[model samples]
Each structure stands twice: as structure tokens, then as C-alpha cells.
Target: MSVDTIYKVILYPFITESIASLKAMTNLQGTAGDPFIDNVDDFRFKGYAVCSDVTGNLDGVIMMHHYPETAIAIGNSVCEKMFDEKYEHTEITEELSNALAEWGNTIVGRSTDLHGRYSLEYNFSSPYFVHDVSDMAKYLAGVTEVVTVPITVEGVGRYYFNLLVRSVDYQQVGIKREESRGIENTHTTTLETSSKILLVDDSAMIRKALKRYLAQLGYHNVIEADDGASAVTMVASESPDFMFMDVVMGEVNGDEALRQIRAAGSNVPIVMLSSVTDKVLVDKCKDLGISGFIFKPIQADSGAEIIKDYLKIA
Candidate 1:
């Protein structure tokens, strides 16, 4: 994806929310610099980078690169806000790493809410801290794209917010330049309420969220499965017109369940949902012939659009 496409579709929402989050949590006024393509092959970490792996509608890693002083300042600020504690350290300490990782989780987790507003879908991993390494490129092995935006935190110095993508299709993910221009003008295609939709996930919260979103989109004939094994049984019995399933689950993971369903001769439009973008898992799902894929922390509007695409509105 181009830098602009990446910015508008993904980074913009993240950076906007991130800056706001930084202000609220650390009470630090921050500004985002213009985003630019970074040379991944020759990239170097300034001191340390806190990284989160992202997958689904998009697949990549996001890094918050910081200098020693910047990391210390931000880490201390976060700790003070969270635990009323501050750190005194010349180098990265375990406590500092824990604080940064927790802050990173808070920032990325909050960003998903805003992503829904933009009809975007993607999943993010828990943040982990990485120190400056001699082989930076090797550490980021599969990343094909990189975009960097500098965040200038008042008095704390500047830290870089970087997006690194393994692979992504802007158009397929509904963020193409031409289409993005008219996104606001697009209208929702309402599907008939008679259609049965299967919602499968171990989390009642997720099932509840999807039920609400489906209700808004005029699909009320919904079925629920708490796990993948149950999902297979429900498909045979309910014969749902559309289905949404989480990839990772207990008893039977989604991929195995999908394989069983396919083996039993069912071709229902099943969309796989997950926060993981592991190539092996994605490729396995594709080979099993999934109808579509959605990144976790699903948004109502974005999920509705995907459902519409698969089960065309009547």
C-alpha cells in the first residue's frame, strides 16, 4: 500500500486516537509529523521500540520507536498516571518495559473503537518491548512496507510511530484511493430479515455485539454457537445463510471446524474472524475456502458491509 493509502485507511485513525490517548493518560500534549515511507532494509532503532503485531483485514507490526530519554519520560508518565509511581533509570528497566507495554495495549485497544467509525477492520497483538538490536532488518523479517510518523511530545522529546506491513491490498480491504473518496456517500444495502445468520465465538460479549450489529442491519434470525464444534453442528441443523466465526477457540479451533463442515459437504458463506494474521493459519483458512475474513475487535458497520457483500441484500 502507498504511504497515503496506509495513512488514510489505517494510520490516520491510529495516530489520531494515539495522540489523544497520550494526552489523556500522560497529560502530555503531542503532535504527529507528516507520514513518510521508511527504508525498512536500512532501518535502525534509536534506543528501543515497543512493538505490537497486527493481522486480519491487514497484516503487520506497529512499533513505537523511542530514544532512551523519551522512553524513560513516557514510561514514567504512564506509571505515574496508572500507579502513582515514577521511575529513575539510566537504561531501560523491567518496570519501564512493563509500563510501556501496558500503555501500548491501552493505545491500540482504544484505536479499534475509532476504526469502526471509519468502517475499518484489523486485529492487534499485545505490545512487547524490544531493545536496539544489531540486525534490525532481520528482526522485522516478513515486513514489506514501513511508514513512520514522528510524535513530538512536549518536553519529552520525539518518538516515532511506525507501521510495518507484511502484505495488504488497499482495494480489497476497502481503502482504495478512488473508493475512499466516496466512502461518505456510500449507502448501506439492507438484507432481508428472513435470512438466518450463525454467530460463533466463545466470548458472549462478541456474540452479543454481533447480535446488536446484525439487528441494526435488519437480520434478526440469528443462531449462536459457543465453540467451533458447535458451529459445525449448527451449520448442519440451522443451515444459516451466512456465518461469522472466530478462528481461535477451545474444543475445536475454527480451522478444524471449517474442515469438518466442508468435508460434510456444506458450502455456507463462512467468514473467519481473528486477531491473528499468521500466514499458515490464513493460508489454511483460504485453502479450506472461507467466504471472507474479518479482523478482530469487529466493528458493526464494517462487519455489516462484509455480510452484505457475501449475502447480497434483497
Candidate 2:
């Protein structure tokens, strides 16, 4: 479909009075010292997949992909703004997951209504989450073409709204055909690197993206921890030179994990990564003596510079 049409379909559902109000409040809050605000608008897609099938005239699937953290963040934002309930952290509780799934369903249902303007009738399946992209691929097996629209939910992060259509001609949908290009070979020298870094987060996408970014910057000795508890254990066993930790995580959070590590007297320099910017939490992290704090959807070059500077990796 035309990019404009795709964009319209993707964002049409969220322009309602209730959601628009929330968006306004979120933008007004900004990334200031508010604890609820984290790195919610990072331009990276590091999360899980929520998909719903659209039948009838539009025979395709609409998928909303978000990082686990991003999903929780969005859910919490919705709860607080729409339901007048406050969630301290964006942990994936059952209630939160259900809320998110329902939100997805609503969006899909509403967007399908727009199809009627084209004299097309559409129906959608219940939304479901998939932990991995590969698992999501199974559902898209017969899809001939796909259109992806990226949108940022204030205080939630970036999300990909994808539509997979079956037996659709690309030209009819305004997609152009282009010749595939081969990879180019270029000689490069590896910079001397020695930091053993640990990346801790629940999102596999974040871990992989950060790991790949670090690798490209010549920081190859990287380790990963999926949660705060595992991060604590890895700290003791791995003895990493530096750590990048997500603040809102399962088991022990970044702050508590840092507390445990400090209580044991291991002064490993750690940088906190988060989408939330709660002042209380930031002060608590400062008290725990964090080396630095980096927002999520980390930029490779700048992040590499921060690491090198902190580790003195000249």
C-alpha cells in the first residue's frame, strides 16, 4: 500500500479523544526528573510481537511489535492515564499483559473499520504475543508483501505496525521493484579493546542489538543477563569490567541489584539504562553509586565513547 495509506491505517486508531489526551500529557511531562518517564522513545525495535489476523476484503495480519519493556511501559501508561491507576514499575504482570493485548485488539478492530471506506469488509482475530520474531514468522508464511510503519508512543518507545498481505501485487500497492545488491568488502583494522562488558535486560532484541553495536565498535568480550537477579550472579562470577543495566527488570531491579553488588563491596563501574526518569529512582541510583546513566535505544558511537571514556580504553 502507499506509505500514506499505511501510516493512516496504523495511527488512525490511536487518534481518539482518550488516547490523544494521554499523548498530550505524556509530551508535556517530557524526559524530566519524572520516575515514570524512561527512554520510551528510543528509535530501536527491541521487543516482542503481538499479532492479529485481518480477514474479508483485507486478507492479512496486522502485527504490533514492541520490546518487552516497551510493551510494559505502554501498558502502564495506558493504565495510569485511562484507568487512573498507578503502576510503580513496568513489569509484565498478568494484568498488564492482558491490558496490552486488549489495547492491541481495540486498535486492530478500529483500524479495520477504515477499510469500509474502500468498500471492503474486515474482521480481526484476537491479538496474541510471540516471544521471538522467528515464532512470528510461522504465521506470515504465505504473505507475499509487507508494509511496516514505525510509530512512537510517548513514554512507551518505538513500535512497528506491520501489515502482511497475501497474493497482493507490489505494484498495485505502490511498492517498487529494485535489483538486489551484493555486500561490499572493505578492509578495516580492529581497534585495541579489552573491556569485558555485561548487558542486562529482559528483551532479547535489546541484548542482540547492543551486542552487535558493541561488536562493531570492537568491544567483543560482551556477556548478557536477562534480569536483575541474573545480573547480580553474573557480576560475581563474570567479573565484568563494566555493566549496562536496565532499571525496570524482574527478580531484582537495577537499583536493588546494584545495592547487592555494592553491599558485597565489588565496585564494578555500572551504567544504568532506563526509559523511566523518576527523580526518586535517579537519586536512589546515585546513592547506590552508579558510574553513569545512559538512556535506552543506545546510540552505538556515543555509547561506545561513554564506555571507552569510563573504562579508560584509550
Q: Which has the greatest TM-score?
A: 1
**Lowest-lDDT window of 10 residues in candidate 1?**
176-185
Candidate 1 lDDT, 15-48, residue by residue in tens: 7766865765564789999999888787777878
Over 92-198, each residue of candidate 2 has an lDDT whose tens digit, in order, gives 88666655654554444334333333443455664567765456546666766566555556555566656666632221222211111111112132224677999
Q: Give the clashing pairs for model 2.
A: 34-277, 34-278, 35-278, 37-276, 37-277, 38-275, 38-276, 39-275, 40-157, 47-67
- Model 2 off-target regions past 4 Å? 1-192, 299-314
> Any idea what lDDT model 1 has?
0.70
Off by over 4 Å in 1: 83-87, 116-122, 132-135, 172-314
Clashing pairs in 1: none
Q: What is the C-alpha lDDT of each candidate?
A: 0.70, 0.57
